[model samples]
Target: MQTAVLSSRSLRIALPLAAALTLVACAPMSTMYSQDSLPDAVKVPAGNKVVLQTVGVGEILYECRAKKDMPGQFEWTFVGPDAVLKDRSGMQVGRYYGPPATWESSDGSKVTGAQVAVAPAGTGNIPHQLVKANPATGMGAMTQTTYIQRVATKSGVAPADRCDMGSAGAKQKVGYQADYIFWKAS
Candidate 1:
């Protein structure tokens, strides 16, 4: 009787442990951050791999101004962006801003990039974008970045308020969020 009881207890513990291990082993190899499902226009170029990822939470500033080359017409033009960059755990890791579109790490490293491509995200959301990074400054997480992809965007579109002559010179702030994936040459 004693031997049977011991065996039963051992089996109970071992069975769950084995099942957990099996489930872990069968889990997919890919991480949650894979760019494979993104639009082709926003994909990082071949030979590049993701080095860092962050969530940008902030607002975009738009200024009402006369439309270029369209006399007597006016519109709201993008002035710039101001956002705080945070890691997956929600820790503030850096900032993103400026007319030049700069990404700066908490460690003082930073990079500016030129727009490479953009794809429509959806109604009421900003477009997904790919940027070709310039050389880094100050050396850190941003140093090795060769490209940046903005994905999973939410609610960054321009304000719907009128931009006609009456609304000209007015500024509007629109909140938005996006996942920024930094890539480097493989």
Candidate 2:
């Protein structure tokens, strides 16, 4: 049987194509978030890169109260949130809760942040949010956190229960789920 051989013309084209494919395959893969499609208001600032990503499964508490500056009008007012933070692997790594909004790791490192901006997620969903992290409280996973983003919101909106004077002082807990992406300065 005669052996087939590649012509010099074919070798020139095939070699470069094969080399390009090899380079691409060997390149480091980045699973990091590309916040490009997110709304500008909720996008993290430049010079930062994703450090950790966790899902927050939780509830938001709301209390029926008189609408501020509107006598006799009542509505549901935000109380706070309580959530369990889990990594993509479904392991519990931390928690999120508070009047001041804290994120704490299982290692005991914790952080609180100030809201930077928020953008509408959708109808019947809480807004996506960006926060600027405060200095961490312990040495661990959260120590270098510079920003946190709340995204992929499900539910977590204000309770739709009757909130007239009759319902005043009543509290409601609404279940919610969201992804919290943590970032650090690159």
Candidate 3:
């Protein structure tokens, strides 16, 4: 259809539709955060660099335990995560867990991070965080993982009803997804 032959009414609709499509095409894709926009913390020295970026899928386990120093009271205590870490192609490549939140690779290399900062990920969603690694825990592919950032988390919390003393020893496994960015020390 030649543009010069279009009817006035048709042109009116087509012009605006075309413009809208053009704008949409040029818009940036939205994500939990981009590198520059990600949360920052002094604990993770800026001199370090990215080593790996993986997506983790699994459960955030929890157990109801008596609150320490608060006799007769109880609370839900985190029992560590159990997740399969995958590369960009979605190939399972490692694991995520520990009170230390370590990432262990198939090659036997790993990195353990201590959380340094957290940013909320909308309501009901887990917060994203930045973490600094404990000194010298890497090997093989993880040779220099000195920092980490966990973001784009989804669904990993236990229900409130399961957090009381009556439910002590009870366990819950809630599924979740998040991006784990590993870093190397300078």
Candidate 4:
């Protein structure tokens, strides 16, 4: 029987390389979006780090509210969001909501971003989009987010229910799923 030993030089180089590869594989991120295909206005500037990626599973809440144009009527108006952001492994990480979509990490870091561009999805599906985040709001994991891209959406829109949409104060909730990629200025 013969035994082989890895040289010190080889081991030094191979260990770190192997560890890096393992970490990358464990990250579980899929289909990283590149800047080349995104609109200039929505693109994240070069040198930003992709800090986190999650699946936002929740509702695009709507409320039956007054559509003042008509004499006496109401319509379903977008009311903000109610979602739980989860990791690729399906672990809950945080939440998303707001007038400007906000992503908050479990550690209290958060970023509020606005839609800048969209790529049309098929009929009955919502479009994917790039959102530009505002300046950091806190000193935590989420505070660094400078950009976000929502992709791989499954469902988001509420059904065209015949229920009287004009019923004031009536609320509706629809399930939605999308990939939320968070970027930070490095």
Candidate 5:
């Protein structure tokens, strides 16, 4: 009888522990990957412009580029405070040409892929916003939101309104701004 009681108690404890372990083993890994998982050197193909800059409280420098080879592709890479990138429409922000990823803003807005744009060399400040936070890890967490504004410019040859837009507006020449916000994680 004592043996039966002890066996039942052990089974009760062991079963839950085993089940928890199994669930953890079957769980999907985190989306963020380690730096070592990436290539040590990234080769930039010809006819692409690379822009590197530092933003946010930590001054995290990021390497970004606009490539003509892909014909309508933009890429950006940055490391900074833990943040949630968003758009003016309150959608989660994402890359212009990379993965088919989506994000949701804190306000529960769905950010899509049609709100991003790349500007020429002489375009105005690419309006961008970054929300900074610090996760438990020492590394600062940052969320960056970017958008291009539609501006009407008058050209001597054609006296018409040239509106600039994101990917949705290809033929327009609108202005864009980059806005950033900072928040400390408790």
Candidate 6:
């Protein structure tokens, strides 16, 4: 009778453990971040200039220009994923003060601009999960996470003559590239 009871208890535990292991093994892969399918030309618009490029998911690379005869230089700020201001040279400009913002314009000469924003993982169109297992026990589990980290912006003098701050500029467009990756936390 005691043996029967032990057998039953073991079966109960083993059945559930087996089911869990199977479920975890069958779980779909996580998709928090992935590569973008859009082409380079399509990603960047027609007239916008090119700028810096990054090597992670949601990374943005593009340029901007100001209208003709604009007065001051292009001045703008970027809010990275951590919600901090980043410099145009791709350096962390300042600490997180508040909701990030940027302001830019022409400085009398014709100039171009560019920017790149590294999107946090898990912001992709599809979702992803991580699977972990214990070889000794044959038990497993899965978790989902994201890995993106920045936001960016750029501004410059427009290619035209008459200064028009509101205008996107005559047929001017910017190009962008978003790269995706599953980065391991350091």
lDDT of 2 by residue, 1-186 (tens): 123345666788999999998777554333477898789999988999998888999999999999999999999998999999988767788999998899999999999999999999999999999999999999998999999999999999998889999989999999999999999999
The lDDT, on a scale of 0 to 1, for candidate 5 is 0.30
Select the stronger candidate by TM-score from 4 and 5: 4
Model 5 agreement with the true structure over 1-186: per-residue lDDT tens digits: 999999999999999999998777555323331223212232122332211121111122233334448655544333222223444343444321122223333333322233233222222332222211112212122232232121221111111332222432223222222223222212
The residue ranges of model 6 lying beyond 4 angstroms of the native Cα positions read 34-186
Worst 10 residues of 4 by lDDT: 1-10
Over 4 Å off in model 5, which ranges? 36-40, 43-186
Q: Residue by residue across 15-38, what tens digits does model 3's lDDT show? A: 999999877755432323247655
Q: How close is candidate 2 to the true structure, as a TM-score?
A: 0.82
lDDT scores for all predictions? 0.90, 0.91, 0.75, 0.76, 0.30, 0.28
Off by over 4 Å in 4: 1-47, 66-74, 163-166
Task: TM-score each candidate.
Answer: 0.82, 0.82, 0.73, 0.70, 0.22, 0.20
The stretch of ten residues in a row with the least summed lDDT in candidate 6 is 103-112
Error of 6 at 124 (Å): 31
- State the lDDT of candidate 1 residue by residue for 1-186, as single tens digits: 999999999999999999998777554322346766888888887898877888999999999999999999998899999999987767788999998899999999999999999999999999999999999999798997999999999998988998999888999999999999889898
Determine the C-alpha RMSD for candidate 1 after optimal superposition of all C-alphas.
6.2
Per-residue lDDT tens digits of candidate 6, residues 79-181?
Answer: 2222222333333322221122111111111111123332222332211212121121111110111122222223211233332445323343222222212
How do these models rank on lDDT, best leading? 2, 1, 4, 3, 5, 6
User: After best superposition, candidate 5 residue 93: deviation in angstroms?
Assistant: 29
What is the Å distance of residue 94 in model 2 from its true position? 0.2
Better of 1 and 3 by lDDT: 1
Model 4, 71-185: lDDT tens per residue?
Answer: 5665677777778999887878889987567788788777887688888655666677888888767687677577898877787765576435446677788788888888877
Decide which is better by lDDT, 3 or 6. 3
